[model samples]
Target: MKLCVIPARGGSKRIPRKNIKEFCGQPIIAYSIQAARKTGLFDHIVVSTDDDEIAEIARSYGAETPFRRPAEISDDHTGTNAVVKHAILWFQENGTPVDLVCCIYATAPFVQEDYLQLGHDKLIQSDKSFAFSVTSFPFPIQRALKITQNGGLSAFYPEFRSTRSQDLEDAYHDAGQFYWGSAKAFLQEHELFSNQSLPILLPRHLVQDIDTPEDWIRAEYMYKAIHSSI
Candidate 1:
């Protein structure tokens, strides 16, 4: 059975109460919950959170919070992999065995049902054990430079210093939105990307990592523009 886990910790320092913050007309987490539900891909859509308020909102959006996340896994210092592992173990102890797990973030308000479906389909169709969304860097990374304290400019990739953008190989970065992986592989590797991992490229407009107020506003605006056209 495929399980979709949305990890929403209560303590958010950058944007206070970020998980429950309103986006468009609903809570920020509502988007991920709705997308997971709409995809109808997983056997269960669960929210692993330490905050009662966030749990309540998650339930209202049709996601189940079978257990409250432990304090250790709910703190800012906690990594997402730890939270996901805890959730998987919680379900395993309860007798509901999971085959695959999708770790969806609460702050990713731009996640769409189609994207989730695509990732799910790819994971099933390919020999890969994991798949996740990514977006290409807007600027050519070959030309990227780092400034030194002595006012010296050095190329991030020294080999690409003399290379033109069009001639350089393309690169992509993690969208920080969602990830899908086999439960067995995750338990063994403790990571989403292993040898058998695939990347799903997403459009720049649909990919935003919301960590600050400015990012939140930009994501909101992008969401509106995308949905308004649809």
Candidate 2:
């Protein structure tokens, strides 16, 4: 069975109650839950969270919270891989064996059903073991810069310093939205990306990683603009 896991820890240092924080009139996590359910792709939508409020919000959005994440896995220093592993183990112990696993972050409010279906379909069609969303860099990454300790600026890609933006190859970065992979592969490698991994490119407007307040505002505006256009 395909399982979609939304890992939301109680302790959010950036935005308080980030998972349940309102975004465009709905809890941020609700967007992902609704999107995932809209696709009807997963056999189950499980939320693994340490916060009771988050669990409640998740359940309100039609996601299942059969287990509360352990405190050990709810810390800021805890990696998502560990949380995912713990969730898989919890299911195993509960007699529900999952065949495929999709890691969907609770903060990604802009994730759409089409993009998710694309990733799932790609993973199922290809020999690759994993698929995830990505978005093209707004500016040429070759033109990126780094600030030195003494305030001096340095080119991130020194080789491309002399090249023009148009001459540089296109590049993409992980959208930080979601990832899909075989449960067996995830258990064996303890990672979503193995040798066999595919990048599913998404429109830049639909991709936003909300980490800071500024990012949250931008996401809100972008969401409005996109939906209004629709």
Lowest lDDT sum, 10 consecutive residues, model 2, at 186-195
How many clashing residue pairs, candidate 2?
Answer: 0
Relative to the true structure, candidate 1 reaches a TM of 0.94
For all candidates in order, the CA lDDT equals 0.88, 0.88
| lDDT (Cα) of model 1 | 0.88
Error of 1 at 64 (Å): 0.5
Model 2 regions lying over 4 Å from their true place: 190-194
What TM-score would every model get versus the actual structure? 0.94, 0.95
Which runs of model 1 end up more than 4 angstroms from their true locations?
none
lDDT of 2: 0.88
Q: Could you tell me the lDDT of residue 154 within candidate 2?
A: 89
Cα deviation at 156, candidate 2, in Å, is 2.3
Q: Best TM-score goes to which candidate?
A: 2
